[model samples]
Target: MLDFAKGPILAIQEFFILAGQAVRNVFRRPHYGADIALQMDTIGFGSLPIVILTGFFSGAVMALQMSRALAQYGQVGRTGTVVSITLVRELGPVLTALMVAGRNASGMASEIGSMKVTEQIDAMRALGTDPIQKLVTPRMIATAVVLPLLTIIADFTGMFGGFIVAYYLLNLTPAQYWHTVWTALEWNDVSQGLLKPFVFSFAISLVGCYYGLQTTGGTQGVGRATTQAVVVASVLVFVLTFFITKIFVGNVVS
Candidate 1:
């Protein structure tokens, strides 16, 4: 049992170690502004289409499904309220983070894992470069900066999607649908939505880097690292969101 528990315990320790070093690099000299910009473009701009598509559709579906339930209570007009609250508070952040994790986390693992097997990372270290500073810190900073922005975009697009459903299917006036959507959002909902993505960004970026840096066995190991990065990053998004929501729930209740 000790042997069985040791591997996971060690892995957790290593992950936190990597996280600390990456964060420390953020404040140190020789800032990789160009690399950080590149990662933002890659992780943020590259992800826009999917994030928008998913956000829009998720809101539309939520509005559609919720309309029926509201209709049962003769409250179909409140579809926008339900759609806005659900999308902003929960669905937008979770889905956007998952989409980013699937795309960038796997990409990070494969890119770094390939560099690892090719000895490029080793060569950097020999040249007096810290791989964590050059590689990990920039990615971490980029994700942290852009994730909240992306969540905000997702929230608006989702509300717009809900508006489309409410306007056409439910025959709600534009003023009515938009009014509910706008008013349904409290500061707490917005804060929770933004905060969840920011927290998930660290998990997604770091998990990928951890798996990539740990990769061995050459090409096959790269593939394994990529898969593990996506799986772990995606899982962490869900897990982190749950805890975040729980905390906010407690605050709201109080």
Candidate 2:
């Protein structure tokens, strides 16, 4: 007489156990440097162009919107600060997480899930190796380590994007713009934003890896896992982002 209402609770319990196992798997190996390096290159280096482009456009749009809104009250100089703050604090990490989730999370999941169904993961397990250790661990370590660094780059590029829009497109004075940034910017704001991405990375990577490890059937499983990995990871990222933002902002939102 199992209660259908309690089925989800069992699932959540299983998920946490897997999560603990995944964490142990990620750290149990002797050397993961190569995998880590590859992940950094893929998530950080390969993602630069898009991060820059999106960041730039976002900044430009923010500046435009803020400018138009502020112009009515003659607060044009404040527009630079507004855009800068928004980009550095909110847009940078959230957008970067979204990008990484889309670009790497799904791919990692599918690659692992595909390996799983193809008996490759099984072969590794049969050979006295932990599949979680061999596969999931590497991705988890890579994502956890690389996310903060990627966020730093994203933040810089995003600010530069705002600068581009502010100066070239909006014709705001460079001196004035820089001054606004200097005066309005705080280390807490920057650090708070950057900090969230590291956690976000873990959520995406772990969920992605978990789904991959659980994948079954065949090519269809891989496809479903890939799609589900992306959706689930992205959703988790946003959910975590909301909480992280609140904590960083010191419950200021509420």
Candidate 3:
């Protein structure tokens, strides 16, 4: 019980400290543009297909369920509005973040953990190179930049999926579905959609980096850190989602 209590507090404290260092390194000297670009491709383009698939299926299923429910009330026309609003305001960001967390977080932990096990990180320090700047900063930067773009892509793809359902399954016209989607979207909703992923990106990257940097006990430890990174990052996506939505949308407690 005491270990459980203190473990989370210590992890939280370390995570924040690592996050602060990453933020500070963002504008510091010796910016790794090449590494950052490579990381962006790895994190962004590499994750696109999964993001697309997740968005498409989520929106499609949402349309199916919502349309059926609304049909019982003779309100099927509201399907587009509901699907679009929910996807843009919540599902798109959350789902995309979760997918990225599952994929990238584990990868980050494993890669850095391998380096740790092999003493590569020590070599960097010995050679006057800062390992955090070379490794953690680029990954964090790339994640921060890419996640919001992926969320935006997921948002539109989900809307497209909803369009397919609204047009065919629900017997709604293309124009009607699109118009509802467009009109129902407020600036705040868009801001929230984009901002949530940005914040989530930070959490995911920092958690991965923190665990990666903490790796010990050889190959088994890498495996443990990889699993821990994914679990913690995924949970943070949900936990942060609630707090972020409350902050932007307001009145969760009230």
How accurate locally, in lDDT, is each candidate? Answer: 0.94, 0.79, 0.92
- The C-alpha RMSD in Å for every predicted model, in order, reads 0.7, 2.2, 1.7
What range of 10 consecutive residues in model 1 has the weakest lDDT sum? 176-185
Better of 1 and 2 by lDDT: 1
Off by over 4 Å in 2: 1-7, 26-29, 251-254
Every model's TM-score: 0.99, 0.91, 0.96
Residue 137 lDDT (model 2): 72
lDDT of 3 by residue, 78-143 (tens): 888899899998999999999999999999999999999999999999999888889999999999
Model 2 — TM-score against the truth?
A: 0.91
- Stretches of candidate 1 off by over 4 Å are none
Q: State residue 135's C-alpha deviation in candidate 1, in Å.
A: 0.2
The TM-score, computed over Cα atoms with residue i paired to residue i, of candidate 1 is 0.99
Q: Which one is best on TM-score?
A: 1
Candidate 2 vs candidate 3: the TM-score winner is: 3
* Candidate closest to the true structure, highest lDDT: 1
Backbone steric clashes in candidate 2, count:
1
Candidate 2: tens digits of C-alpha lDDT, residues 1-254 = 56986877876676678779878765565656687788778777887787777777777778888888988988987876887788778887788888888888898889989998999988988888877766767778888777777777776676676777778867888888878876777887877777888789888888788778888999999999989889988898788878877786775555
Clashing pairs in 1: none
Candidate 1: tens digits of C-alpha lDDT, residues 1-254: 89999999999999999999999998899899999999999999999999999999999999999998999999988888999999989999999999999999999999999999999999999999999999999999999999888888888899899989899989999998988888888999989988899899999999999999999989999999999999999999988988999999999899
